[model samples]
Target: MTAPITMFGPDFPFAYDDFLSHRAGLGAVPAAAHGTEIAIIGAGIAGIVAGHELMKLGLKPVLFESDRIGGRLRSEPFKDGAGAYAELGAMRFPPSSRALFHYFDKVGIETIGFPNPLAPDTPSTVIELGGVKHYARTKDDLPKRFAEVERAWAEALEEGAHYGELTAAIRARDVATIKRLWHHLVESLDEESFSGFIANSKAFRELGFRAREMFGQVGFGTGGWDTDFPNSILEILRVVATGADDEHRLVVGGVEQLPRRLWALVPEVMAHWPSGTSLASLHNHVPKPGVAKIAPGTTKKFAITDRYGTTTEYDAVIVTCQVWLLSARIDCSESLFHHDLWMAMERTHYMQSSKTFVMVDRPFWRDVDPATGEHALSMTLSDRLTRGTYLLDNGEDKPGVICLSYTWSDDALKWLALPLDDRVRLMLHSLRQIYPTLDIAQHIIGAPITVSWESDPNFMGAFKANLPGHYRYQRRLFSHFVQDDLPEPHRGIFLAGDDISWTAGWAEGAVTTALNAVAGIIRHLGGTAHPENPDPIDRWSDLAPVRLVE
Candidate 1:
């Protein structure tokens, strides 16, 4: 694993004393002395990669971020004596994440496959209906309740089977397959509910029994397609199920180690802006009403506000903030920003999820002779009793160091809204459900519940995903930076984010979009760009043969 790069060592960017001294005098920086090639907002993976690529081309790119350098990939010190960090958000990575893996390899960040000891010995997925636990040992073992899943899967394949032979299934005339795929997508993608889709399916009578339970398992939350803009659930499932491997991987040390390495690769030409500073607004030079000034030169300005409310500006700005945050600052009337983009962005739904990290003074689960060594880090589907827990091996030599994360959906919003005491009681209750053998109340060191989706202002949700009709608008919203559409002098402000790329809502998506944005910027700068590898999995016709077992 690569060591962290310490840019500002002894002196933190803004000292508390300095903050107290100049609490109110913060203001925006005025006009630029020279023109900037590119400006990216939100220093997440996409912005970081885009800036890195542009710097390689000898263009001075400026980046802006409202929070820490690593967006969702943040790690906090565990409250227990584990002597390791706990991940607040994203946790797993697949082997097919070539771009992500390549970046890690280039930067010398090592990774190990996500371990599942229960696998082969026991099924990984468990369905908790009421108080009873039904272990899904295999596809065939899915409770009689989920019988409709087979039918839904079959119907989806049948609809698109004809497009398998076509050169471009996307262009095939079979709208039925496309529509079936759209219906199976999560609510965030389409207005129709899973129940509605199952109802409309050929075997509704047979599958309707498990409707509510199945919906909970497969349903997309606020971040899914049902919210602001809906996405095709079928397409997302196809991409996730087909293109990727089943194994999960962990970054050596922590996930933050990955971004820290990427930051080191950035060239000297690209300016490194401090965290918490974001673009407030843009200033343009307009000469006349219908006809604007033709210096052919444009000055990209920003109004960056820091954590302490201190605001500053840069000549050129590279915005890496969330779309919702950026929408507030941009002047849509200039035609430089698309109205459709703004609308879609405004309507985007963020998931209300929470992570409660409990540091135990002792390894309670180990009392039951729990799986030891690298066989830790157990991943389990959530249940009403246990909620859900991802056990992490803090990489400690001692056996007692363990971090338990409770990832809950609607309960999070409710828990966060409740008073402190009520929240604590609820959490303890949830924890007890999982470790019935251990005394959770006595061994607890600290329990910090991070409600990311509800608290973070910049990003309303965790990441972007497609809904039913979202694909129709995705190409337009994601591909907003076509050469002809952008403002003067800067034709390469290609849209790049987890939402913009084909792989939406993952580290891979961020990397893919960054590569695409870099390609666009390189082309505009009269430089060559590298081509991406073709997707290995075929979307339309690669379904596994269905069989009937009696």
Candidate 2:
């Protein structure tokens, strides 16, 4: 049987999964470097992971956060909850996210199949388009046109990019083959947008414009990715090629528990620190205030000033916050990064997203309609303002949660000005048009919750989605961890976050990149990886990402 596709990159195809599972435990710093202070900004997954690993390596990591921990993995529980909650940021996680799953497994976080549209776990799915609704227990129940669109997408992938071979290479961990195929694609499609790739594909061209429009509206694996049409085809290809869209699962209780637990976890074995040491224990159970400024100190160190007028200096700094924050929220020194790196940070594009959720009395949507004998409501995908609505059932006799609406990009922008009450009403109105007989408002209990990440002062947007012609910028950021070529001033401050990774929006990227930063910090402090379990930087030259000439 073929091995399952992991997020072993086509860009930098390193076996991070293998590295973490090894007994070496992420390498070690010298005795002199032990307890060396390294400042990490943002208490999100990236920051937390970096701190955890660095602490294991005998380094003292000081973490600063502007808001709550977990970053984009924000899960807000309902007041009447039996573990029912709204996943405001990242809800569904793909099985291919092996690195992220490693942390989940370490923390004993359980997961269940997410009820994505057409997923087997979902009881039924409803697709609404052009004011028409169709109910399906599976894809086979959809009209033949949907099948044709699915086939066209497959054909487009095979014809335009030889996607099958690329995926096979990735599964086999064939670095040379993966690089050869992906290099050709980067050269050909770096400047091509996703919509352009569709229009130009022979299969899509033959399928006609209407089919293309439907493909956008009812996209496979999640739903309605039309908002991403303007992004690089390379970005879309990376997702599908690595199987990042398949077999998604949600945390059983909430994803917030993963980071929170990690903060308090005392690893079975570690360097320098005592057996009872944990990140929580090190910081006295709370992280420092948000950072306000970072600049060069007089004695070859980085001075960090937090929001509360406290200043401290560290040997090295790793920033895991959104790249835009460096410019928008903090007063950062220009000399900390090279001009090219600065331009890449400036060019990074973040997609906006909004999610409105409400707690319902029970799983009332599962009731069979007496007149039609069909489910009253289903996991819905629509072209309406409420792009996608999900029914999250906790259990029998317990209050259920419903994600009334989840929208991205343009659709998300529409909800930016509306208040929570107005947002909930508008979503209910849109959903009602599909289920005319159902009064969704009647089942709603307690106050509704809503969020527009772009509106949040700390995070300007939901997540990064690179646009066409932005691959070079991505290359710059991803390759920055191996900083031997950079000048002295730019050497100490490293970048690690989803935005700095090849796959920006996914948590796997955050984990993998944090590992990269950990390795970088170890090396900077005169440490080396165990020979048997080398990190990404140890294999950098052989597996370095293909660079496009300017």
The 0-to-1 C-alpha lDDT of every candidate, in the order given, reads: 0.46, 0.92
Model 1 superposed RMSD (Cα): 13.1
- Model 2 clash pairs are none
Worst 10-residue lDDT window, candidate 2: 77-86
Model 2 root-mean-square deviation: 0.8
Instruction: For candidate 2, write residues 354-403 as lDDT tens digits.
Output: 99999999999889988877899999999999999999888869999999
Best by TM-score: 2
List ranges where model 1 is wrong by over 4 Å: 1-37, 79-82, 115-127, 134-195, 203-205, 218-231, 241-245, 266-318, 329-335, 362-382, 399-411, 419-424, 431-437, 447-449, 485-492, 528-550
Clashes within 3 Å, all models in order? 35, 0
* Candidate 2 Cα misplacement greater than 4 A, ranges: none
The TM-score obtained by model 2 is 0.99
Q: How far is 481's C-alpha from truth in model 2 (Å)?
A: 0.7
- How many clashes would you count in candidate 2? 0
